[model samples]
Target: MKKKQWQGWGPGEQAEQHYLVEPRALAGGGDIRHVSEFLRACGWRDRSKPGGPLLMDSLDRSIRIAYDPFVHPGGWTIHGKATAHQEEWTAILGRQAPVEIVAGLTDALTRPRSAHAPNVWAPLQEQRWHTPPGAGHVTAVSPDGLAWMQFHQDPGGHAMWWSGAQDQQGNGWTAQFTATTPMHLVQSYAAALASPEPVMRPRGRVPHSARIRTTSVSVLPSQLSAWKQARVTAARAATSARNSWKTNRPRTTAHPHAQRGVRAHR
Candidate 1:
């Protein structure tokens, strides 16, 4: 069957064209969770386990690599004939851009545009410098203007963020994007060209937890005793409070002269 134009998990025209149980696909469809399950059910393939439809993400990463050409940011071609792009970036999302590249790309992407003529001035933006989506370009150049960088933001919905750069010698390398995406991507491209292990290059704040050795954690005997004492004290205080409340409660006595139904003065 002809795949849907988009790469994401959706039935599209595939439902009507291929094997799909309409009622099951539509069951609990109002909620997104059930809807996706229903769509997966429509494309159920494992005949041995007919009831269990494999999840989209659970599909091997190789599938995405195969579909890389049709993937987003539309301009993967600019990075040359590399298929590792999607697989690599998806693995490295939270990782950071290198330190050195960050400074240069900062100057590039955030460089003030000349109000006189933005066209005359390069179109510099703070984050992923805009391209005609999926297209890559010379997003930034070095301070000395000796080197330049390129980046491609996936035109598709996936945030598989990586970009490439080439130096004066025409050597190129790849780098990942962090949450600090656009500027850093611009920076990482330049840095990647210079550094041999660009992807593994360390940058950004070291997490505090990384400094500590993790051993089995347990409450000390003294701590446990203190906790027990505290609980006992709390229980005693609650009982004391309850008793005090009952003792302090106001009491009423009826007088012979008072109306039968009226509450007697306390």
Candidate 2:
């Protein structure tokens, strides 16, 4: 009898995946007691189990208790079994409460941005008691999800925020904070550098010294070349000395014989 070769079908022909059966939705102000009943009816565990009812009950209660709107504004909640002993509820809840509260606070603080507009600027009209008088408005910048730079006021009085790529050669940017003359100049420079349009250039070559001015003298090319050559020569000499030492190393026998000859002559 000849053996058969099986050619397996590709992924598209594979059996569809399935998930664990989800708990049926509860109705009419379901609470912890209801959740425990449902789980028991579903044959999750027997009533005699240490955590069978109490554990499920507590989790259900936690889910039902209204989370601080400031923290869980989305109204999302979760319910699940915990592995710790039934008596461990006190410790678990104590530890979990602070963490949950912190998470809620963080969510509340950050939620406004996503729910709001692309760019929003809040100008400070007056300095508060804590802040100095006329201490001007500060601007913040954010890109993607989080803010990078916080309220920083530039030399100008006007306040605004900016975001995006870092400034690099041929891709520079500037921001303005005030409308004062100096600020205007800064804005001009920023606009000039940030414009997407290519910058116009003179066809002729400009002298290097004209581009940048410095009071200190710079080394001439000839001098720099001479210095480099001198360094190379010194390094070569040092290497030769090391090689010669290795080649001319005295043998132990030769040293002993020379010492004996010197003692005999004496």
Best by TM-score: 1
The residue ranges of model 1 lying beyond 4 angstroms of the native Cα positions read: 1-99, 102-138, 141-151, 160-165, 168-172, 178-266
TM-score versus the correct structure, for each prediction: 0.19, 0.16
Q: Residue 25 lDDT in model 2?
A: 8
Task: Write candidate 2's Cα lDDT for 120-216 as tens digits.
Answer: 2322111111233353544332221111222355676443433222212222112222222122222222232222222111112111221112222
Clashing residue pairs found in predicted model 2:
156-178, 157-178, 158-177, 158-178
In model 1, the worst 10-residue window by lDDT is: 20-29
lDDT of 1 at 231: 42
Whole-model Cα lDDT per candidate? 0.30, 0.27
With a 3 Å backbone cut-off (N, CA, C), the pairs that clash in candidate 1 are: 72-155, 72-156, 73-134, 73-154, 73-155, 73-156, 74-134, 75-134, 101-187, 128-182
Residue lDDT tens for model 1, 119-156: 20132333223334443543554332322334434557
Give stretches of model 2 more than 4 Å off. 1-215, 253-266
